[model samples]
Target: MSYVLNDPAAFADESTDGFVAAHRSLVRRVPGGVARTTAVPEGHVAVVIGGGSGHYPAFGGLVGAGLADAAVLGNVFASPSAQQIYTVAKAVATEAGVLLSYGNYAGDVLNFDQAEQRLIAEGIPTRTVRVTDDIYSASSDERQKRRGIAGDLAVFRAAAWAAEQGLDLDAVAAVAARANERTRSMGVAFSGCTLPGATEPLFTVPEGQMAVGMGIHGEPGIGVQPLPTAKQLGELFVEALLAELPDGVTSVDGARLAVILNGLGSVKAEELFVIYATVSTELERAGATIVDPEVGEYATSFEMAGVSLTLLWLDDELESAWTAPAYAPAYRKGAVATGDTELLTDDDAAAETETIAAAATPEAAEAGRTARDVIVAIRDMIDREADELGRLDSIAGDGDHGIGMKRGTVAAARAAEAAADAGAGAGTVLALAGDAWADKAGGTSGALWGLALRAAGDVIGDTEAPSAHTVAEAVEAARAGIQNFGKAVVGDKTLVDSLVPFSDGLTARANEGAALAVAWAGAADDATRAAAATADLLPRMGRARPHMEKSLGTPDPGAISLALAMHAAASVLNHTTAQKEES
Candidate 1:
């Protein structure tokens, strides 16, 4: 169950090689094996950035037409050497001079300082900007010591634009400094990340708890706190940033900001958006005008389950630069129409009615009802066993799978009930369930559940009265679709270990002319058996495998939950059919 590369040294080299190979056209290797890009427009202030390898798009992904001119990549969580930085600076600097912008960590500062000295000796003008924007990192004395998080993007963009405008070295440095001053970022981690091929995580957090102000490279956080809802988390982050704002600004009246909601690694866009919506609304209420809002995986730490919020106070110049069109591999902007009153007021009721009507089929409706009931039962079972499942996953995983599964299942059930009460049919119910999972669940399980429900709805199609065979076919199609998307094989000790067997058993029985009741029951039984058998095997996928022996004898909670769901479906189908016959 260990990772494919256990050692950080090797993993870092392999990853950097792959990155350079993939972007060969846009990047070139300099004297110190540092990669440099010339995509930035000439005479634009050349911004050279660098950091460890694992934080994709941070040091490299932003290198392109509108962003960084060059980036020096280092080993995992380690800063590149001075020679590397100097080489990249030499390669990318234009007549306006180069701006060296990076996080304020000791390693980065030490290395970049050396590079600056070297660049000066070689007659190349250079300026340095160190990002120290994490409010939780330290108090006044320690403020300079805090590590940078996701605010590097804002600093880089502002400094680069200033440089592009042919600002002097001091002015460029001031722009970067001001951007850093206005920027404050904070992050929370639900789970730790594994170095490539590592058997264990670099750090660990307790289940149902989050580590606030956790560093990107597994540094200890300011404190551990109970996991908050996305809305609550957003409020807390916004409050923290607002509290730390310079006295004159953010006093409930004078704050104008650009907000960046960034995913650490594994957090999905849907979940990130929820946080963004909450933060944006809260800021608006606080009298802050959001000049720019960037949401995505702009910075990451190899599948870490966490997110960060970075706020930058906006001046007129900074505002213009922030909104200025810039193209990068990961960030971009296009012309957007302003204040389209007609489009905003267009009739949406008719479209909404058509959409709902299209999804209201009898067979789909019945399937949705069954799914709702099954999800409720599954949620109950998970709640009862949540602690035990957490203990099991804790040994080889982050231990949140149990809690995540319970939350996702319960959310799905509630959504289904709400949709049904609203007189929505199966497709609408399933869509609601998917959205709930996407909202409440923050990791791999949530994504899978969301995908599964959506695929099931798609398979049911437009039919109002699908036969039993159609139902079975839809189930099979869902199983296949999940398998295709996830790429988990039967023996991987993944949910597929149970689901594949169940799908096959059901298909066999259905094809043999067995009653739907008998077929579903058999399928549920087989799934349960297969899930139990997974205890004897080791997991080879997801975050669990890193714990090695931890999961050897414990069934994957996902697999067990899937079996429970099938059994619940069997009960619902049998009861419904008997009542129909009697009537």
Candidate 2:
């Protein structure tokens, strides 16, 4: 069901080949999985970087004309060997000497130290800069043992720029060491990632939950806990990071800091920005000035769904370099213009455009009069089956699907009634229903339903009257939008299992000249059947996939609910059409 590259062993080789090929002009591959800068200055200080492979742009991609002189790459979730370290050091060393900089993982420390001795024996000067910026990694007594996270970017970038500017080996190493001392990062994962070729995920978290302080290599986190809202999570990260800062430390010239919000893959940009908004507010309250901030997937683990926040206590020198001109496929430093202007006139402006209005035309009013009874009937059926749905989800999912569906539908029905009373258009009524579902439902399902409703409403915007065909087209468009945005397919064991079939059946019936109500009712039946049939299929995505075997034989709650809603819609359509014909 999930379409992923089959050969896991080939991941490292394939990825490295593509990476080097793309940046061949700026970087060169050294022996032992190490890459070096192609345009190293003759006597400039050398900067060496290294890390595990999956967190690209950290260790390898940063090697270039203005960045690291060399980078040693490791296998996925594994450390590079000592030989790999030595190979890179030898390739990039100069009389001015090489400064070895990398994360604080145990394997990295051992191998890098081994390579440091080897380079020294060869009469090539080398110094080590260990980065240990993860606040969750250890207590104050054992801070040196903490693993590095996004803070490595700031350390490496600052050190490399110093080296590029002709700082001596000791000076460059000192700058990097200072950056590590002042920086700290913390993260939480919504889900874990699968290693190449591994059918099972590396770790697991309970559904509808998250693991705080999870390591990059799928290491067990502090514990599984309720997933926080973006704002709440941001606050947690900021509080922890600030607690770790020294009492009197200020940015260079006594300013505050610059923040880096690094996505751990699969976390969307919108979510990251939401987190950033919360973080900025917290920083302001702490009397810290954030000179600049970065938000994006700068470091990742294949497709892990999480994010890490890195805070750097900046000096004027570091600030300049942090803002210096640099570019790579995955990392860049650029200015973003901001002004003291309000983008929205009011809080409602922040709501989706389709959410604010709810009015139906005369034709839609008639349609809703018929549809209202059907919706009530379906809602009653869902209320009756709530226990069964919960038990099924408990086998593999968070077991909240039933409750979420019940709440969403109840809210939607109330909104629909409100729309009808307001004499709103059909689309406006649907939009209101969607807003209700979104507001009531939590987690991914709520977001998906909200998006689907918003898309459908946009398509039917301001229509004075709508026929069955128009309603069908709008629903089809909404379904397409859900498919586009959610990237879900029929066998993903999502609502699509029911929705796809329901939409197809409805369209087929409509094409064959069936009345809208009759066609919709038939489609609803097909959806329910399809969803029941899929009980034998394993879920292939989201939190349910980790418990795939358990999920088997349990129909997806979202799918079942979707089918129920479609059937209800069909019944209402048929009643309205019949009434029209009689009149």
Model 2, stretches more than 4 Å misplaced?
Answer: 1-6, 34-37, 247-254, 334-583
Name the runs in model 1 displaced over 4 angstroms: 1-8, 31-44, 247-250, 335-583
Q: Write model 2 residue lDDT over 13-117, tens digit each, in one string.
A: 577777877876556566545444344567888888886677876777777545676777765555565556776677667798889988876446655766788
TM-score of each: 0.56, 0.56
After TM-score superposition, what is the CA distance of residue 152 in candidate 2 from its true location, in Å? 0.5
Per-residue C-alpha lDDT of model 1 across residues 356-420, encoded as one tens digit per residue: 44336565566566656656776777778766665565555545456567666777889878766
Each prediction's RMSD over C-alphas, in Å, is: 20.6, 21.7
| Minimal lDDT window, size 10, model 2 | 342-351
